[model samples]
Target: MSFADQADRTLEILALTPGWHRLRDLRPDCDDETVAAIVLEAANFAEGVLAPLNPVGDRLGARVVEGRVKTPQGFADAFRQYAEAGWLGMDVPEKFGGQAVPLTLHAACAPLFERGCVALMMAAGSTRAAAHLLAEVADQDTANEWVPKLATGEWAATICISEPEAGSDVGRLRTRAEQRDGEWVVTGQKIWISFGDHDMTSRIGHCLLARTNDQPGTRGISLFLVPNEIDGRSNGVSVDRIEEKMGLHGSPTCAMRFDGARGILLGKEGRGLPHLFTMIELMRLLTGCQGLGLASAAADVAEDYARERRQGGRPDQPPVPISSHPDVARQLHELRSTTEILRAAILELATTMDIARLEPQSGLDDFTGWMLPLIKNFGAETGFNVAGAAIQVLGGVGYTRDWPLEQYLRDARIMTIYEGTTGMQALDFLTRRLWRDEGRGLAIFLQKARDEIDAYATEHPGASEAALAALDEFERLSAGMISMRDDDPDGALYRADAYMRAAWSVVSVWMALRLSETNAVAGLAAQFAFHSARCA
Candidate 1:
């Protein structure tokens, strides 16, 4: 399906979600018609303005000239148009110069933008996420100063966590912030900083974590907002160099050096990691959107190619479209099924997160937390796998630069690695989400799935049966892993990947059942059943 089709399906799924009315009531301007229009406009902009830049950005990439990073040609202009269109602040609060629409709407629109040009969208995501982070954690004055700038895209931002010594082990970071003359100064070298240096915006801010005291590990780290320019002058922030990455060449991932750059502390001094999670969570969710965008695009390409490209047929007859072949047909069904189900799942999570924000006591937060890691990891995997599968369907032509599948494959490779590796997500799911949370989220998910199955069982017995069985298997596996938590934590960690796979299978079944209720995608429900069964 195309990105526009995905957006329309997202609206269908959103209306089907429980409590969607309540969410709609909260954001009156985000009613179904309004959101549909917004998404349609976004789709048009993404296709007309951003899609053309995808290949250009990949080919030209970003370059550094005289210490400043220059994004690929048209990137800066495209971002300007994007900002002017108010795309950056769709979900940000109106108080901070945003439209403050429901995140579900943003989620629906995001994949389209990502599909258009993920490389440029990297800068957009961080800026928007950082604006929300500041609105939540920074001091009123600090938020007032930065949030609007970010919301309007007058400036861009980066979440600086990884360093030479600290990648996933954030505790070992050596960046330091010192208080001097009633001002904070940060001194550090941060690597793997996306949009670390870009000409898309005049000012760039770093949501940096730096050691501030003698406390050990993460305890000593504090969050700081360090700008690249202060009072129209350089603030001692310099780009040492931009990495020559395998993909996403339009986004300049930089190795940055801060030589005592003036900084403002955000949130509590010792709660940097916890505070940063605000931004990290949103980015992780967006990573899933990124994956979905690429996967959808790949599916569209493969399906189109299969219908047009003809090859083998009976010797006595003329060649038929490859899509007529059983193998190609099956692959197309699986691809479409996986893509649509993942879209539903991501929208569900996004809606759940919206509900969690609206009603803190609703217990949806735990459920959202439970599903975040799964979506992040599997979402990334789906994009890469789908692109590879699409390449196969297109034969040798898909592997060549003439097609976008290869670029999509290369670009998607980082999603699994960056937000948190698949291993990291699995470990987090098993240890923190399942074990530490006491399976509250798991309980919520299981009950929810069972409710859906029971609701649809009479009409869709086949889908319900498959879903229930998968849910039962998932529950049993989860219990087994949880039981091992005390006696064999290491063993549980070892089984984390398996447990996560099972969770994805179960979730896929649930999503397939959800999609089965919709007329447009009902045919793919059986495909999901087969896919889930095989994966499980």
Candidate 2:
């Protein structure tokens, strides 16, 4: 935590603010107070133990021997420490010896681990995500038998969908699954399987997808839980190779080859595409934090550097810290402001998921169905920008291994590419979320923003002109979007991302507004709103 420059004000802003556990408050059905405590404690441990290891991990990288991957020197020890703390089961069901913590709290703290080292975060990430999807789709016996071990970290898990040719076009996946001896045999080559193999866990299950000859396109595929180890044998699976990655080196990405690996059917046959979509949803939400968490770390690092480092000199004048430099301050400010918004956005969506889980019929559930990817895409992309700014603030040193920015950059690069790439996200936002069913979801989100503006305007007539203009422009642009839907799809969707930006800004600021209503920070809320409005 060397500080060439740092921002006391920025730190004060982050530290003094109280984070609302919105889900617990809004939805009583999904109580997670205990879960929050567990998540925060683990987050603190991760920050203390794992964050310190990241620079070393990046320098050391994961070793690939033969076809097996070994994490950086200390990662094994740290992973043991992590599991010893019972961090793995936080999100799994209580029946499976998991905490079954509310999604919001888990979402809240998941970022801290990623911030420590995103590569390593990806290791268990897909497991939990895929496992949760299994809980949704698999039979009770399957969940009972596998979830406990998976949650306890006795087994690792992964999602297998992408191949050499089938990425964004999930429908094009050519992996084949055929029934044999009352079980399915899977044969496919999957790339980018994070933590595809590790010596730390004995059992590895892959939530795999392949063609089943029932239907063509995505419907032809079904999800199967393929165990990598059975009776100490290969289980018809092989690690073809590990990816030589740019960052998150502590976590190895593998290309896996399945030679008729025996797997249990997950969920229903031919429902794999939709069932697997749930896993994608979960991963997208979690991966949203990946980029944001890493960017937040970069911001924290830059802020610390700025506050303490004295660069420019004056003969008679006292040396000013780098934070005193206007450009540095601006970078820190942008990073903090946008990060604040990003955190707010993610938290909002997290709470939405929690509420959905609690009250299945609550509008939040349907809203989350569409909004999850939107928030994920928004958070990560902004996070990339924030991490880049943090790097710029660090200058040449940022590009070197001597500092964390290069690792941050390498980590950020994958965020835009993985889970779902930025392009897919944009397409999802415009076509699936925004215009789907004539844009009901987007309209709901917009109404929420409008309600905030209306409430704030009524309560505080002195609301800044900036806020008002931003609100007005938001309304205008939204109208433009609606008007163009019938006449110009491209023009309309071109601004879909812009609309997303505006919506994120307004909603984030509104959160600060609504939150400050109880926190006695009306001025800060107004400032957040002003910054949000600047997106227009």
Candidate 3:
């Protein structure tokens, strides 16, 4: 079925989900129509502007110069189009040269960029997110000065968190931030800094994660807004080199050296991690969107290929496309189904963020805190699988440059690795998020899912019955598993992903159903819901 037809069904399901209804009602302070216009505008811009570059960007990878990197030929122009169109700061507060689109709308914006190239998508988005962090935590003077220009895309930004010695182990990072008079002098190496030396912006801001020697473990690490150029001059910072990566060649990932760089700190002195989380979680959500975008692009490519690539077939056949092959069809189905689930999962997280944004009274902050890793881990993993499967659908040709499948695969691999690996996300989710506040936050999430399922059944009799039946089996299985592991907290902890899956299946399908019911907006979601069930 056409994606539009599928969107109709998907939007209907969205209408039924409380979260979506909440989105319709919240609709930001802006009029519903205007907010929606921005949302559609972004989706269209991404489709029209960025989407076209996916294959081209792959073929014309970024080129490294003597001291800098230049993005693919058309990349800078397209990025300028993207930024000048106000796509760069969709959710930024309007007070600061941004549209301040609500989180729900911002959530919708992500898939479009992801469907583009991650290198470009993240490059634009990371700056937007950085602008957000500065708004939230930076001193008013700093934020006022930076947020406006940053929102306008006059500047680019990167989060400098990793060192050669520390990737996930943030506590072990050796980047040092020492107080010098009224400012900070940051000295250390920041590895794997994306967009590290691109020429798109006159200046770059690095949100440096450094050890302040205040305490121990993760707490002592502080976040510093270290400008690559301080006071209109290079702040003793130099790009050591850009790494040769497997994919996402359109974006330059650099290793930077901070030579006692003068910088300003954001938030309280030692409370950096919590403040930095303002950006980290936001980036994780964006990364999840990145994964989704890559998956969507790959799937679209695969679908088109399947419909065209003939494998010993006649035109008269209904399923003559290579997509007709049982194995190929199965792979496509799995990929599509997983994509739908991940998308549903992402929308669900979006809903949570919307709630957290619109109704801060809901205490959904902790809920979102728990959900960050889920979106990051699940979305990244699915993108990897989908990209790989897209290549698989093309056989030997997929491995070559003749088709974009290989580039898709290569670009997607780093998604699961960068922005925190799946294992790290899962581990963080299990050890920290799940049990924090003595599981009170988690219980709320479980209850929310339960409520969503109940509401779904109430709205749609037959499907609700089926969904409830499935929920019953799942709950029973879950309870039995829990009972079996009553003495084994470790086992329960280990089973987190399984538990999350079963929980998500029930809620996710309901989310699809809820989205399916909405008829008032762009109908892609409705098409998505029906296709989800068909693909499932």
Candidate 4:
């Protein structure tokens, strides 16, 4: 089946009505049919242009030739087509050459793009995040100049956060910027800068963080915008080398050097880390969307192959496809059901964000804030697991380079490690979301889950029991952690991964239960039952 068909059907099965209604309430001019048309167009472009280039990009990754980073074959052209098609500006504002569409609409189309080529999408993803941050926080004059170009894909942008010695520990970074003749001159070496030095665009804008004072940790850090070119001349920014990676090779992971580069200060001084977090949050959400797309793509490939590959049969009858086998069927069902649940959850999350933007004090803000880490960490792990299951369905052939399953597995592996690792996500969830607020966010989510379960129980008592039991387990697990606060202060944190899993299992099953009403026979009940049994 085509990606368009898959996306449409998934949206239908998941019943996007609540999210759509919320979005429409915010933007009255937005129409569902128009969004659907755009999604179909995106799917066609993904299959026709991006999908064909996936293997080509993987085979011939990005390279630095004579100080300039060059992307794989067809990358530049495909990106141009992607930009011209208005995808870059779809969710951006009309003031900046964007369509100003609701984010929920964009969320629906994300998987199709990632399904086509995840590597290629990374560059665009970073740029889109950069554009969003600029729009939100940059000085109006500076933003007006840069946002339009980024929105139209006429310029690309990158986030420079990691250094050789400082990956997750941004406070330890040694890069420095000094005020000289009314300009900030930056000098530093940054590693793991995705799309850091690509020739796909004439100019690249970098959102860099550097120290300006002697204050320790993140206090002295300030954000800077370093252009790839200045006044028709090369900026001090240069690509030292591109890292060879396990996957997503087409997107450059550059080691960059800044030697007295002219920097435009972004936001206020000494507040760089906080401002840059806007970009990080946006990137993490996009990364989650990427995971969803890849997992769905993996399932697509697996199901297609399984339905055709004959395995066993009676002597007089034709051999049945491997999909007829119980175990293989189970894997496919898990993959499909998990992907659909994640989709619904992500869209709901997006709707919350859309609402929060207009009404910051609204209770939805807390949910949006709390959902980011889970969406990113769980989404990434789900993609990885589903991709591996896809390989299992294909048996030996899936492990070989002859098929794309191996590539999918390799590409999906990095999602958990980058954009902040899963461990980091768990820490944030436990400490920031739960501990610091004293369970404010957790209480909200649990209350919402309870309400849903009560509504569901009225119709399907058996499924409702399973759902309530899962929620009960979550509460018990959380209570045990909370009880250890004084004597076993670090115990809850040490078991943060377990907590994350438990919470996700409950929330995901809740989402599945909601979706089951529309897709009652889609085996979601069985899926939730299995998960609830495990939670027990």
Candidate 5:
């Protein structure tokens, strides 16, 4: 099936009207027709441009020549088309060469591109995040200088955080920066930098974090906006080499060496982690959309395959489509239903992000913050599982390169690792978001979920009750975990992963319940209830 067919069905299943209405309220300039047009155009581009190149890109990947990385076949042309079409500026400000649409629309449109070619989408993803970062935190002059180019997709950007020794432990990073005359000179090495070096554009922006003083840990860290060029020459930044990775072959993941690279400091001094976190959080949100897109695409292909492939049925009967088999049906159901649930959750999160942007004092920031890890971690893990299940539905062929399922699984493996590992997300949920606030965030989240269930229950008792039961059980587990924080601190840490998963299951069911109000799938909530009960 084509991406347009698939995305249309997904938009319907998600029942995006209410969210659309909310978005319209937020951005009066973007009406339903305009939004629909944007989504359709994106879907068409994904299907027509990116999908055909996926296999070719995977086969060729990106290669380093001289000091630059060359992206796979058709990548540069496709990227240029994506830019000229103004997609890179979908949610950006008009002053920065953007269309200034609702972020919800961007979230809705992203999966189409991601599903078509995730590696290609990564460059756009980094650029969009960089544009947002500059608009939000950069000095006015810096923002004016770079935002227009990035927003217009004239260049690309990347987040540089990891090092050989420091992965999640950003506080231990050894990258250093010092003032030289009036400019800062950054000298260090960064590893696992996605889109770090690519030939798709003339300039690449780096949102870099490095040490500036003798202060220990993350305290002395600072953020800088470093470019790949200065005065028509290399800016002391070299692409040491690109990593031979398991997936995302088309996207260049580079190991970079910075020797006296000139940079403009972003935000405040000695507060780089916090400033860089703004971009990190944006990337995390986009990463969740990436997972959702991949899962949706995998489900589409697997369902199509199952409907066509003939397989065993009753003993005396002729073979029926594999989709008719009970186990195969279950896999399809799980894959589609879970993908829909994740979509709803992601959209819900996007809506809240819009709200947070429009009304900062509404306490939605806390909500968005607490929900980030859930969206990022759960969405990623679901993508991997759904892709694997798709493979199972395809049988042996799914394991081979003949099908995209294998590639989907490989691409998904890194989502849970990069943008913060699953373990790190759980730790942040427990240590930073949950334990730091001492359960207030969780309480707020539970109340919001209950409110949604109650609102949904007025019409559908069965699904609502199922969701409520899951919510109650989640509440019980949460209370127990909170008590364990003080009662058995070490034990609580040990159980963090289980608790996080259980909480996400409950959250997914709540989203499913809300979705049922519009989609009205008979057993959707029941399935979620059963799974969540097991987790509880």
Candidate 6:
């Protein structure tokens, strides 16, 4: 299925969710036809405008000329068109110049755009997340001042957390902010900042974290909105240099310096890390969309190549399509199944997120928390792995610049590293979501899985068996890990990766059942079963 068709199916499923009525109450015009139209338009724009730029950006990249970072040709213009189309504010609140649509719709549209060009679409997530963050945390006046611009994409934003000394250890960041002469002055340097300096927008807002007091660790850190341009002049924020990355050259990964840059404090002092979680959570979710986009693209390319390329056959007969081979056919099936399952899982999480927002008492928030780490990590892995698999399917041509698979592979490499690494996600899942939260999320997920299995048991009895077994194994592993946490924290940590994989297997199974019910993708449940058995 095409991305648009997948998005349409995702919406249809989301509409069937329990609290979907609440979403309609929130947005009266959010009917199936309207939303699907929006998604279709977005998919068209992404394919026609954004996908073509993927290769251009990869080749030309963004460059610094005369101390200013200029994005590759057509980037600035494309961004302008993107902004004018109001995609930047698709999920932002209407009061802040956004459409205020359900996040489910946003999530549906995201993968389509990401599949078009992840490097360029990188600017969209942070900007939209920043708008939401400001709406939630910032004062009315501050939010009023910045959120609209971000929502409109007249300005772009970046989450500035990492520094030379801090990557995942955000508390180790040394950037300092102090009030002087009735204004906050930020002085420090941040590295590995995406789109830190870009020509796509005249102004770039750094949603920054800075040490504000003598308190230790994260307690001293505070969030600030530091703009690159203040009152149409420089704000003492300068780009030191842009990193030469292995991929995503289209998006600039910048090292930035702030020498007494004026900043406006966001939220409360000494609460930067917690407040930034608002943006971090959204970015993490979007990271999953990034992976889905790449995986979908790779799957499409490989499947197309397999159907057209003729190779092995009996010596007496003419050559047949490689897809006729059992081995290649198996690879294609696994790739499609995994990609589609991940898409369903990601979209389900997004729908749950919407429900959580509309009806917090539904207990779906914990479910979202439980699933975020899984989707974020696995989503990225699927993209990179699918791209590599596509390269293998295409033989030598895929490895060369002629095919987009190599570029997809290179661009996808960073997804696992950024937006919190896979290790960090696994630890978060094992430690906080499972252990500290007392397995509330796990309990919810288990119940949901049971309900799904029961609902489909009669029709898909054979399918339910594998999923049920996987579900049981996940519960056993999670319980054991939680039990071991106090006695051997290191042991628990060591098993975190295994625990995470088991959880993914469980969710994939559940999604496979859901997909099977739709009959949208044939044999996905069995494909998942085959893979689960292999892993077991």
**Clashing pairs for predicted structure model 5, backbone only:** none
Candidate with best lDDT: 1
Lowest lDDT 10-mer window, candidate 4? 517-526
What would the per-residue lDDT of candidate 6 be over residues 95-201, giving only the tens digit for each residue?
Answer: 98888888888888889999998999988888889999999999899899889999888889998989998889987889999999999999999999999999988
What lDDT would each prediction earn against the true structure?
0.89, 0.71, 0.72, 0.83, 0.85, 0.87
Model 5 per-residue lDDT tens digits across residues 1-536: 56887667656644543444565676687765766777888899888988888888888999998878989989999999888898888789988888877777788888888898999999998899899899988999989989999987788899999999999999999999999898799999999988899888889989999899989999999999899997789999999999999999998899999999998899999999998887888789888888988898899889999999997878799889999888888889888878888888888888778877887777777777888999999889888999999999999999998889999999989999999999999988888777787777777788888887787776778888888888888778777877888799999898888888888888877767766645545368866777778887
Tens digit of per-residue lDDT, candidate 3, span 1-536:
22232233234333444676677767736454565565556656766777677777767777678767788877778778888988888789998989876676676656766675567876887798899999999999999989988898888888888899988888888889898886789999999888877878888888888888858878888888888887687798888877887888778788899999988888887787788877888888887887777777677778888888877666676446677678888788767766666777777777778778778988887877777777887788778888888888878887888877677778778876777776677656655665444444565666776576566555565555555455555546455444544467777667766665554455455444544353321123233334333322
Ranking by lDDT: 1, 6, 5, 4, 3, 2
lDDT of 1 by residue, 169-217 (tens): 9999999999999999999899999989988888999999999998988
- At residue 32, candidate 4 shows an lDDT of 64
Candidate 6: which stretches are off by over 4 Å?
1-28, 517-536
Candidate 4: global Cα-lDDT? 0.83
Kindly report which residue stretches of model 4 are placed more than 4 angstroms away from their true locations once superposed.
517-536
lDDT, residue 295, candidate 2? 70
Residue pairs with colliding backbones in model 1 are none
Candidate number with the higher lDDT (1 or 6):
1
**Predicted candidate 2 versus true structure: per-residue lDDT over 1-536, tens digit per residue:** 31111122222223322223445466454444444445557566767777888888777777667767777777767766766676767777877787777676677677777777676677668777766876778899988888877777777788887899998798898889998878889888999888888776788899888889857688787889999978888898888887888777777788999998999988888888788887888888987778767777888878887887788868688888989878777678767766665666676677667766766776655567667766777677766787789878887777777887777877778776887776677667667665664667666666655565566665554443345555666666666676777889888767666666666666656555544443333445566556555655
Instruction: Please write out the lDDT profile of model 4 over residues 102-198, one tens digit for every residue.
Output: 7877887887898899999988988888888888878898899998888878899999989999989999999999999998999999999999988
Model 2 residue 471 CA deviation (Å) reads 4.5
* Colliding pairs, model 4: none
Question: Going through the candidates in order, what is the number of backbone clashes in each?
Answer: 0, 9, 39, 0, 0, 0
Supply candidate 2's per-residue lDDT for 406.
Answer: 72
lDDT of 2 at 131: 63
